[model samples]
Target: MLPEEGVNAVRVVVGMLVRGEYEELETLTEARRLTAAEIAAAVRRHGRDLISPPDEAFRELGGVAVPREQADERAFHVDFPLWTAQDGLSDLTLGLTVAEVMDGVWTVELDGVHAP
Candidate 1:
């Protein structure tokens, strides 16, 4: 579920978030993109670990499709709801900016992780 594979990229990124896999998370960030890095940094700063959250936390992996203008067909947004029950860190939706690089192929990148 690599971020390069946009289909299940959200789930992979969420897993990385819970497991504190900084390097792996960094790899998923879009090249030269600072937003993703900042989000990762904020999550790390909190030092919250759920250990093993319930399966329900990941039930919303596909995310909500966001409408885009005709000229912006190459890229679009999807907000994936990520549930959590841990103290301090509650549930949040991961905002993903997906880009259709070439034809059917797409790349998923973290736009932001925030409370919904």
Candidate 2:
């Protein structure tokens, strides 16, 4: 099972992914402010299952390392499989700040990419 925090993080990630608003850094940053508890509650309210444990649901979700110019911060990169989306690849790349992963949200810019 995914930790509550991880579950929460995935919730916002999935929501943004579904909305197609995840391509902008500013939008993602705003979405990242949502709390894990908030995400969990939203998931329950929305009746959606977006993430599972590392060995389970997320096994297909690939993770990559993100390097930050600042020495005090560490970032992570993630890519959701093509199956996660209704159409097209909703691959996601996330950058987390010092704030707990459950609380912080980072944004990426998707330029010149059009959704079908």
Candidate 3:
């Protein structure tokens, strides 16, 4: 479950997503907007190589549903806070991703994260 603030934020983002408006996502600790591609690159560069490798520590927090097309009957959305456990540094930045909601949850195949 999300806190009051996170729940409110999700509401706003979900509204925007339904309208086909994709933009930066906000969390309790970080403030920035990141594209799906940008987030993927960052994760590959930092998290997979130097910082935290792909492991159980990296997990999905939650997801938001977005529209793929006005005509298409497919579903879409992005996941945030792909929490990756860190060593000494803060793990806030390690948790970020654009994921596709599948089977009532986010799919790892379509997810991407970033590191700071």
Better of 1 and 2 by TM-score: 1
TM-score computed on alpha carbons, candidate 1: 0.57
Superior candidate under TM-score, 2 versus 3: 2
Worst 10 residues of 2 by lDDT: 107-116
Top model by lDDT, which number? 1
Can you give the TM-score per candidate against the true fold? 0.57, 0.37, 0.28
Q: 6-111, model 2: which lDDT tens digit per residue?
A: 4355455544544544334335555455443443343344333333223344444433445667565434443333222232333322323322332344333222
Ranking by lDDT: 1, 2, 3
What ranges in model 3 sit over 4 Å off? 1-44, 47-61, 70-76, 83-85, 88-111
lDDT by residue for model 1 (6-93), tens? 5455556667766766566666664435454586676665445434446554454344445556554455566655545465335665
Candidate 3 lDDT by residue in tens digits, 13-65: 43332232333332311333556445445545654323322333223334454
Residue ranges of candidate 1 with Cα displaced over 4 Å:
1-5, 35-37, 45-47, 50-74, 85-89
Give lDDT per model, in order: 0.57, 0.38, 0.36
Summed backbone clashes in each candidate are: 0, 1, 1
Better of 1 and 3 by lDDT: 1
